[model samples]
Target: MKYANNIAAIDELSASEGVFTTAQAQRLGISRNALSHACKVGRLERVAHGAYRLSGAPSSETDELAAIWKLTASTAFSWERQAKWDGVAVGGSTAAWLLGIGDFHLSPYRIYAPERINSKIESARFGVRNVDEGDMAWMGGLPVTRAERTLADLCLDCEDPSLVEGAFRDAAAQGLIDSTKLGSLLDELGESKRRAALLEPLARALSASDQKGQS
Candidate 1:
């Protein structure tokens, strides 16, 4: 019964996804000593500092998200504790997808942090950057850049304007981005005209949408 309970404890610590952290074991009513013993017995695998995986858990890209959740935020895996997850925000192409405003799938998952994090990861490539946190929000249980911030950053720093424009259209059509908020963000960022120019096509589409609604 005790061993069965330990298994149940491990299941809870992993959030049923089979990934957890050393710090989380204690919080889950399992001692660090027990975790170490589990590791020795091949029940757990240390994936990185304070991060672990069930020995035969299904593999997926989300495992990296689990590791990051450990590093940036507290180990508590409840919605109530998510308030403390201000340390990281998903960014770049990854944010575009997570925000539900783009279809493009690019490599090297990107995350914006208050500061750069040097860490090892498996199953995904990570591009962590210390960047401005103007438009930070949560999507699909992950802290990620808001649509306006994601599109603006793409327009400002990325080499491909066409891709950025497509993402802009998708976000605007879905009402995922607020033009007024985007404008204000650009004003604060400076070079407002230049950046706004990048979104001209989206503006035209919105104008057309407005006219159709009126008609």
Candidate 2:
């Protein structure tokens, strides 16, 4: 099959690092048949279900992650859901890795969403949780947990408390984490005794640092 290049769609993809979704194409008045024709003619590459990258466009390190995120809301373009993007984001150790604050990586990428996700992909895992807008940040055009929240999640979910401590130190050194904001998150997580037990050491460390600064 032969087709003309969807110049308008390509222009839109260029603005978003050569990535676009089916819904986005439709929004530009390109039909599914047109998109499929573009793919067949080497004008586009389907990266995931409903996600595409312009053919020959430079690939981004975050392309796979971004495509996966788009699947969480296959019907809505990313910019249209800026209010929170359905509360979905990269999270846990994966988030720390993206933020460059930890020497940790999970085999299955960790993603958090407001509701349960039954993903069939072997390389991704999903967790159901509510994330506040303040706890989210942008990285490579995808949403991810901020440093403070990522550390707090590690403190609660990681088996090795030392790993959380190390990540916290790294983030603090890079000025990516605010001690005051972390303190509040710790207090909020401490409401659960089990969580408090896990977070106590970090909380104490933060307190000692505050005291030393005064002295």
Candidate 3:
């Protein structure tokens, strides 16, 4: 089953935004030998120990995040490790920018890494914070915090809520996350009352977008 250029194989590879793992290749009916052959001849480029990228794929900042998924979540590992790390997701203001939701891009992109192994990010600006319930989702092929989660996490990391309100509004207006989900999450906030401010701007932005849409 060496369909290296098979449309389905290519689609599967591209879905990870050009990043894939050995397990992913196997599922795509690409044998390990086929994988080695592809890399040997230049169709794929090996990344790190167990990741590969389609040769000539366009570069992207999300590439780093995608690489994380390939190496961590997608790698072959014990069942316990998979279950434990399933909640890991890229979070904080950097996540907003990564999801095209806001302009709150900061160096050392933050990730909610509860327990990481061999996870040395090359960028100095990349930061890791310990958090529970790191729910994740796909954002244009990158593993990222859910839209609502991203906003909530940003609020915790923000110094001035006013500064990031516009970004929150933009995200809400774009309908990137569900209001109900956000409400539920907010309700769970133990002492972080400041996050409540996000709701107002989100409502206003969604309202404005709705009115504009109708008019």
Winner by lDDT: 2
Q: Which pairs clash in model 2?
A: none
Q: Which candidate number has the best TM-score?
A: 2
For residues 2-50, write the lDDT of model 3, one tens digit per residue: 3646545755665544777777667667677777877887877776556
* CA lDDT, every model vs. true structure: 0.66, 0.78, 0.61
Which residue pairs collide, candidate 3?
108-125, 108-126
The TM-scores of all predictions, comma-separated, are 0.67, 0.85, 0.58
Better of 2 and 3 by lDDT: 2
- True-structure RMSD, every candidate: 4.7, 2.7, 6.8
Which regions of candidate 1 are displaced past 4 Å?
1-5, 16-18, 29-50, 53-61, 74-81, 120-134, 191-215
Q: Candidate 1 on 1-215: residue-level lDDT in tens?
A: 26678888997766653567776776767777787888999988877667788888776655666566555554666364455555566677777877666665633566666566665645344445444545776544666778887776665545266677778778878888776777666565545677567655444544665577679
Model 2 worst lDDT run, 10 consecutive residues: 1-10
lDDT for residue 181 in candidate 3, whole number 0-100: 67
Q: Which whole-number lDDT from 0 to 100 does residue 169 have in model 2? A: 78
| Residue 146 CA displacement from its true place in model 1, Å | 1.8
TM-score of 1: 0.67
Task: lDDT for model 1, please.
Answer: 0.66
Model 3: what TM-score?
0.58
Question: Which regions of candidate 2 fall more than 4 Å away from where they truly are?
Answer: 1-7
